[model samples]
Every structure is written in C-alpha cells, then in structure tokens.
Target: MALAIFDLDNTLLAGDSDHAWLEFLSTLGIVDGEELRRANDRYYRDYMNGELDMGDFLRFVLAPMAAHPRRQLDAWHCQYMQERVLPMITDASRALVRKHADAGDTLLIITATNRFVTAPIAVELGVPTLLATEAECDDNGEFTGRSYGIPCFQEGKVERLRQWLGARGLPWEDSLSTAYFYSDSHNDLPLLELVGNPVAVDPDKILLATAQERGWPVLSLHGSCHPVT
Candidate 1:
C-alpha cells in the first residue's frame, strides 16, 4: 500500500499543538502559568530558528506537569483533545485524509508533538499509524520529562520514518513510489525530499520558497487570519 504522511502542527491544525497544550495545562492549574508561558515562547522561538534540541524542548515544556498524577494528565489530555483540538481540524484537511483512506493508502501522522496529544487526533482522522515524539515514564506511570527514543524532529524524524518502514519490511524506495508527504516547515526537508510527492500546506516562508523553487504543490486551507510564514 502507498503511504501518506502528514505533519501535525500548522499543516493539519491551525497552529502549534505544543503551544496549545502548554496553554491548556496552565488553564487547568497543572502548571505554573507565567513560567510555562515564558518557556513556551522561548521554545517556540528556538524551534523556529533551529536552535533548540527536541529533547530539551520536551523537558522544558513538560517539567511542570511532571508532579501531577499520570491519570490526571491523561484526563486533561482527553479533554483538551475533545474541546480544543477536534474543532480545529478543517474540512479541507479532513477531505484530503479521507481521499487517501478511500484509496487504501497507509495514512500516518508524523509529528514533533507528543503521542499522548496526537494519538486521539490520528484516530479521529482514521490514521492507523503515528510517528511522534515519545515522553519517558516511570513504572508508576509518572512522566520523566525525558524521551525514551529520538524525538521526532528534523533529522530525527527521517530516522524514525526509516526505522518504522524498515520494521514493516518497507524500504524508502518501495515506499516512495506512490508516497506523499504533507508538511509546513523546512524542518521536514529530509522526509519531504524522500517522498514522491511533497505538498506544502500553509507553509512557513522558507518552506514556501523552497517548494516554489522545486515546483511542489502548495495548499492553503484557512483564511488570511491564519499566519502563512
């Protein structure tokens, strides 16, 4: 079966889910509001500027929630998924996913967002596979604010994709024949180049310019109010 990989943040949703999740945690009083907000802003800046490492970013963002019970965090995650994230899934993106599903393509979400947050959204979209940053947990199910594997960002994303495909007896060459990738950032460049078709969805300026140079398809679903760059 052909593979269709989609990015989660700006490509699938209106904005960054990581930022939204942090904001949600603050609202629930699970995190220190001012500190988390400031850290999130710094992380966002560093991430866009290609300065922050994935592991560091995850630790920084999740540290505040580390003291909370795992069950409580999971409950909040479910509520956040239902209330905030679900409504943001645009009809156009849903249609794209549906078209791929109808074609019997292997739909997967490859995101830097944590799996705890993106898993429900993937299920809602009928995507069976998800490649995302995984947070480490203890035997008691408490988050360690650390990752067990490579955080799925930049080169780490490409590595995880390759590993996933390899485990399924599918190589990049085999997957690339009818493969498609949807993303919004230059950070996804490696996987974008590996796919047969690269679609830029509400891309950042760098990604848009690169896609333009390469003559890749570009799609903008949301209105002018949504930032495009």
Candidate 2:
C-alpha cells in the first residue's frame, strides 16, 4: 500500500501547533510567558533560516519544564491538545487525512515536535504512526530535556522516517512510486524529494521556491474547505 506522510506544523494547520502549545502552556503556569515568547521568536527565526541545531532547539523548548514532574507535563499536554490544538485543526487538512485513511494508505505524521505533544494530535487525526523527537527522561520519569534518539528536524526527519519504513519492511525505492508527502518548509526537502508526489501546502518562501524549481504541486488550504488549485 502507498504511504502518505504529513508535516504537522503550518502545513496541516494554519500556524505552528508547537507555538500554540507553548502559548497554552504559558497560561497554565507550566512555562514562563516572557521566556517562552522570547525563545519561540528566536526559534522561529532560526528555523526559518535553516540555522536551528537540533540539540539546542530541543533544549530551548523543553528546558522550562525540566523542574516540573513528568506527570504534570503529561497532564498539560493532554489539556493543550484537547482545548487548543484539536479545535484549531483545519477542515481541509482533516479531510485530506480522512481521504488517505479511507483509501487504506499508511498515514504517518512526521514532525520535529516531541512525541509527547504530537501523539495526541496523531490520534485525533486517526493517523496510525507518528515519527517525532524522543525526549530523554530520568530514572524517576522526569524530563531531562535531552533527546534519546535523533531530533526529528531537517535531515534527521529523513533519517528517522527511513528507519521507520525499514523496520516495517517497506522499501523507500518501491514506495516512491506511490508515496505522497505534504510539507510547508524547506527543512523537509530531504523527505519531500523521496516521494513521488511532493505537495507544498501553504508553503513558505523557501519551500515555494523549491517547489517551483522541482515542478511540485502547490496546495493552499487557507480559509477554505477545498484545496486551491
């Protein structure tokens, strides 16, 4: 069966869900409002410029919760997912996910966001598998803000997705003929190039330029239920 991989941030939703989650966390007293806001602004600039290092990025996002118990983080994530992320899902993205699900294709969400945050979104979307960054935990189950595996961003995304496919006995070459990938950032170039159908959804300038150069189809789901041609 064909596999359909989706980028979760701006591609699937109107904006970065991670940023929204952080904003929500700030309200919940789990994260410092000023610190998170400043860090997020810097993160966005670095990410857009392709200058974000995986380790640094992970630490920047998770460092605030290092002192908090893991249980509290889990609770905050669940509440954030239900109250903020779930309601922000766009109809166009949801319909696309449903289309792939109804066709029996393997629907996967590949994101740089930690699994703790992305898992609930994947479940809500009915996606079977999520390939995301794994944060390390202490013996007592407290977060260390360190990665147990490769951070799922830039080239790391391609590496992890390939590992996931290999473990499932799916060959990248064989699947390329029917595989589909949807993304919004230039950082996803490696994975996007591996698929036969590369779609740019609400692409940023870099992604838009890359798509144009590669002749990939560009799709816009903003403010509409149907994809703009």
Candidate 3:
C-alpha cells in the first residue's frame, strides 16, 4: 500500500490551527487580544509570503503554554477544539482521508503547527500518524516555550519525515516510490517534490503556479469548509 501524507493547515483542515489557537486564547483574555492578534496577523502574513521566521513564531506561540499549567492548557484546548477547530473540519476533508484509507494507504498528517495543538485533531480525523513541530517540556512536564529538535517546516519537513521513516525501518528511497503528499502552501514544496505524487489541495497562489508548471494535480477540498485563503 502507498503512503498518504497530508498537511494540517489549509489542506486537510479549512484554516490554520496555530492562528486559530492564538485567536481563541486572545478571546478568552488569556493574552492581550489586540496585541496578540496584531502580531499573529503579521506572522501569518509572513507565512503566506513564504518568509516566516519559525523560531520567532514558535517562541511567540509557545510562551503562553509555558505560562499556564498543563491542566489549564488542556481545559482551554478542549474548549478551543469545540469552538474553533471543529468547524474547520469539513466533509470533503473527511472524504479525502477516507479515500486514502479505503485504498489501504497509510495515513499521516504532518504540519508546521506544534504537536500540542494538532494531536487531537489528528485523532478526530482518524489519521493514525502525525509529524508536528514538537514543543519542549521541562522536568515537571511543563512546556519550556522552546521547540524540540527541528521545526517541521519547509525543508525540515523532508528531514523530519526521513527520520520518522528510518525509525520505522522504512528506507527513504523505498518509501518515496509509493508516497503521496498533499499540501496547499509553497513552503511544502521541498517534501512535495520528494514524494512520488504531490497533490495541491486549495493551494496558494505561488504553489498553484508551481504545481501547474510541474504538472502536479491541483485539488479543491473547500467543499463545505471555509474558503481556503
């Protein structure tokens, strides 16, 4: 069976989870709503332009998790899932996932979003594997506001996936033969190029152009979800 890898933001989901999480926190008054939103918007713009500084963005996003207890963060995340994330999940996305499943392809969701925010969403999608940027933890099992290892973005996604495959005794070259990666951002081009089949789902402007030039399949999973930006 082939491997199907899906990007979390704007591909399988209708929107960016990292941005939504921060917005949820701002609305709860956990962080300064106006300030965080302005900064978030800036980072998001950078991301859309393919110029995001992952280091700075991670620090900004993870700081709030560092300040709060795990229990409290978990509670807020539950609410965030119900209010923010659930709506982003759409029937089209679910059907795409099922399409891969019915074909006996291994399902994986890999995203630049941190694991704390995405793990549950993976569960909701019924995808059994996830590769996400890991947030560091302290001795007390609390977040340290730092990322662990490499942030899974751009070229790093290729590295992270390679490492994951190596750990599972799947050789990098061998796995690529049957691998299919679906993404919407130009930033994912590195991994997309490495896979056997790369599908652009509701791709951004730059990615759409690249996909067209490369003769890659362009898909639209925005059937019932919010229109992909």
Top TM-score model? 3
| Cα lDDT tens digits for candidate 3, 90-165 | 8888888998899899999999999999999999999999999999999988999999998999999999999999
lDDT of 1 by residue, 172-219 (tens): 787876799999888898889888999888888889999999999888
Q: Write the per-residue lDDT of candidate 2 for residues 1-229, one digit (tens) a residue.
A: 6889999988776677778877997897778899888887888898899888767877777775686787888888788877888777878888889888888898999999888778888888888899988978888888887777878898898889889889989887887778999999999998888889999988889999999998998887666534632
Best by lDDT: 3
TM-score of each: 0.93, 0.93, 0.95
What C-alpha lDDT values do all the predictions have?
0.83, 0.84, 0.92
Model 3 weakest 10-residue run by lDDT: 220-229
The better candidate by lDDT, 1 or 3, is 3
Output the better candidate (2/3) by TM-score.
Answer: 3
Model 2 regions lying over 4 Å from their true place = 225-229
lDDT of candidate 1 at residue 81, scale 0 to 100: 84
Clashes per model (N, Cα, C within 3 A) = 0, 0, 0
